[model samples]
Target: MSDDCIFCKIIAGQIPAKIEYQDDDILVFHDITPQAPLHLLIIPKKHITNLNEIRTENADIISKIFTQIPKLAFQFEISEKGYRVVNNCGKDGGQTVFHLHFHMLGGRHLEWPPG
Candidate 1:
């Protein structure tokens, strides 16, 4: 894990986060600055820099994240209401943290062409 990465620090117990779920390969937590009523982040334990760095070998880890999204949405009381999962890529994509993560947002109407 990169020492400078915040998500890595969170995963290592070096930084505090409102964790929602955790397993051997992944961790889910609440967003510090929430955009929606239920804004959460799903992250992998491995220190991947971004989505471009994901490899075929990481399929299982990625798949597990997808499989848990619905459950997490339900837990956050947003499943029946619907939700959106997002991944910001690079600087232009508005990614502040380099570590790969997915943002789960719900509990409000999402408009088209998100900024």
Candidate 2:
């Protein structure tokens, strides 16, 4: 884990978060600054700089994260209405944190051309 990464800190128990789920490889939690009524952040326990850094060895963990998404949406009751899963790649993608993570948003109608 990256010493300075906020998500890593949270995973390490150094920081507190409204964690929704956790396992040996993944961590799921509510977003501090939510864009929708239901906004959750899903991340890997392993420190990955960004999507561009995903390697063949990371496939299993990545698959687990994606498989857990729908369950999370259903658990939060956002599945029927639909949801959005987002990954910001770099600074230009509006990613403030470098650790790889996905934003799950729902509970409202999402418009096209997200900024």
Candidate 3:
């Protein structure tokens, strides 16, 4: 884990967050700045920088994260309504943090071609 990674800090329990769920592989927490009514971040325990950095060996780990999103949304009461899972890749992709993570947004109608 990178020493400067915020998600790493959150997973390590160094930086506090409104934790929603956690397991051996990932940590789910409420976004400090909510976009939708249910704006949560699904973070991998193993740091992978960003989408551009994802390697073939990381496929299983990434798949596991995708598999957990549905359950996590349901757990947070956003399943029946629906949700959007997003990952900003790089600077052009609007990725502020370098860590690989997915945003689960729901509880409202997300506009087409979100920014």
Candidate 4:
């Protein structure tokens, strides 16, 4: 893990977060700054930077994150209506944090063409 990465700290238990789920590979937590009623971040335990850095070999790991998304949304009672899964790839993509994370947003109407 990167020594200065915030999400790394959270995963290592060096920092505190409202964690919702965790396993050998990923950690799920409520976003400190929630955009939707059920806004959460599903991050990898290893520091991956962003989607642009993902390698083909990481397909299974990426699938694990996607598979867990609905399970997590179901726990929050937002799975039936639908939810949005977002992964910002770079600075221009609105990625504030360098860590690779999937934003799970739901529990209300989400606007199309997110700004």
Candidate 5:
């Protein structure tokens, strides 16, 4: 994990967060700065800078993350209406956090081609 990564601190319990789900491989929690009515972040425990850095060995772990999204959505009661999952890759993509994470947005209608 990166020494200064906020997410790593959250995972290590060095910082506090409103966690929704967690397991051996991942952790799901509410965004401290929510962009939507139901904005949450799903992140892998192992620190990877971004999607571009994901290795072949992490393929299964990546699949596991996607597999868990639906279940997490259900737990948050947003499965019926729908939700948007986003991964910001780099600086140009608006990635503020260095650690890779997926943003799950729902609980209301969302416009396409997000700004």
Candidate 6:
């Protein structure tokens, strides 16, 4: 884990987050700043810098994260109306945090051609 990464701190229990779901490989939590009525941040407990950093060895963890998203969507009652899964790449992609993470957005009509 990166010494200065905020997500790492959260995963290591150095910080407090409104955790939603957690397993050996992943952690799901409510976004501190919600863009939708249902906004969840799904991340892997193992630190990954970003999407570009994903490699073969770590691919399974990424897959596990996807496998959990739908379940979380259902748990948060957003699956029926559908939801958006987003992963911002870099600074240009609006990824303020360097850790690899996905944002699950639902509970409202998310506009097409998002910013």
Top model by TM-score, which number? 2
What are the TM-scores, per candidate, against the unseen true structure?
Answer: 0.96, 0.97, 0.94, 0.95, 0.95, 0.96
Q: How large is the C-alpha RMSD of every model relative to the true structure?
A: 0.9, 0.7, 1.1, 0.9, 0.9, 0.8
lDDT of 1 by residue, 64-105 (tens): 999999999778788887899999999999889999999999
Backbone clash tally for model 1? Answer: 0
CA lDDT scores, all candidates in order? 0.92, 0.94, 0.89, 0.91, 0.91, 0.92
Candidate 6 regions off by >4 Å? none
> How many Å off is the CA of 64 in candidate 3?
0.8
Worst 10 residues of 2 by lDDT: 53-62
Tell me which residue pairs clash in candidate 4.
Answer: none
For candidate 3, what's the RMSD? 1.1
List candidate 3 stretches off by more than 4 Å: none
* Count of backbone collisions in candidate 5: 0
Clashes of each: 0, 0, 0, 0, 0, 0
Residue 84's lDDT in candidate 6: 98
Q: Number of the top candidate by lDDT?
A: 2
The residue-level lDDT of candidate 3 at 29 comes to 94
The whole-model C-alpha lDDT of candidate 6 against the native structure comes to: 0.92
Off by over 4 Å in 5: none
Q: Return the lDDT, model 3, position 76.
A: 72
Question: Per-residue alpha-carbon lDDT of model 6 for 59-92, expressed as tens digits?
Answer: 9988899999988888888889999999999999
Q: Who is ahead in TM-score, 2 or 4?
A: 2
lDDT of 6 at 12: 93
Instruction: Please provide, for model 4 over 35-96, each residue's C-alpha lDDT reduced to its tens digit, 9 standing for 90 to 100.
Output: 99988999989899998778987756798998898788788888789999998888899999
The true-versus-predicted C-alpha distance at residue 39 of model 3, in Å, is: 0.5
